[model samples]
Target: MADLESGEGKTPVIDIPEAVGVFDTFEDLQQAFYDLRMIGIHHSDISLLANEKVLKEKLGKAYWRASDLEDDPRAPRAHFVSEEATGELEGAIAGGFFFVGSYIAMAAMLTPASTLAASIAAIAIGGSPSAVIGILLARRVGKHHKDYYTNQIEHGGILLWVRLRDKEREEMAVKIMEGHSGRDVHVHSWSK
Candidate 1:
């Protein structure tokens, strides 16, 4: 299938580096996953999907996985990814907006405090169960934000991308991707 897809309008591209530079290491990536309660996705499906060989041979692996609920070891549709095609997963997590934590926040709410003193007590002892409750309440306001944004990004149907700050470098990368497989690689930027 042609990677360069278009219908009524042009699709926007996103840069990877600018998206992930907020983090310096994989540990930071792990924290984001933990905060979002998304570590499990990474540990299970995402990890298996990221194998390098798997990515190249079965670029649509995850899409296929979503088509069926049951596993069939011998199924012909199985995406047999190899070991060498691993993408820099750390990059994807860093560049992509992690949203599960935000989802949790939106779904949960706080009960009003019966008295100001209890609320004050909760604030004074941060990390106390009461304080934890307060944090959860705060999260209720911001929780839906992350999940919403992440969904939009993923809805773009792009798993990995590169962000080039320099125009020349950006063109070079696009040219390279075009040369490689005519895969219709795209360049992304914050400016939109």
Candidate 2:
């Protein structure tokens, strides 16, 4: 039951019904999330499937479909990270690379024997590759975070879970999910 009724608050939260689904695309996942919010679903009640790394760490390197984890309450869930956090991470990665490159170049050139032109040349030589590598790595990070939903779809499907307060919200959630191209949209009798 919802935490709405103040007097009957003694009702135990033993089992909670949850709507689950698999989204095939990022747009569908996003639209579903928005629609859920419009329907008064609290953000706390929504969760996404864990990322590839977490899955790997927990389940080992064995190949597994996302479907396998959908109904399992023990399956790990990913905490949502906003676009701002991802952007900051990308900036840090790139900046760290540049800093390391400059430091190493200075370490090699800060000597009386090194001319200004030689020092500058060393910096360019060392820094150029580092900058390129940084860009590539940063791009990789963006792909892992920004495109997470679609990437999960490629692996199997992007799993979404919405805790349902009642039959009405359950129906609404399933409808919104399916309308956005979700498959196997249904409500489990209990949730984690």
lDDT of 1 by residue, 1-192 (tens): 112223324434333221111122233323333432221222221111133234335343444331231111111221212112223332333223233333333233233533566545434442344334544554543444334333423433212223345666556544543443322345333311
Cα lDDT tens digits for candidate 2, 101-138: 88888987988889989999989987878878887898
Against the reference, the lDDT scores of all candidates come to 0.31, 0.79
Off by over 4 Å in 1: 1-130, 138-142, 158-168, 171-184, 187-192
In candidate 2 the C-alpha lDDT for residue 161 amounts to 90
Superposition TM-score, candidate 1 onto the true structure: 0.22
In angstroms, give how far residue 164 of model 2 lies from its true place.
1.3
TM values, all candidates: 0.22, 0.63
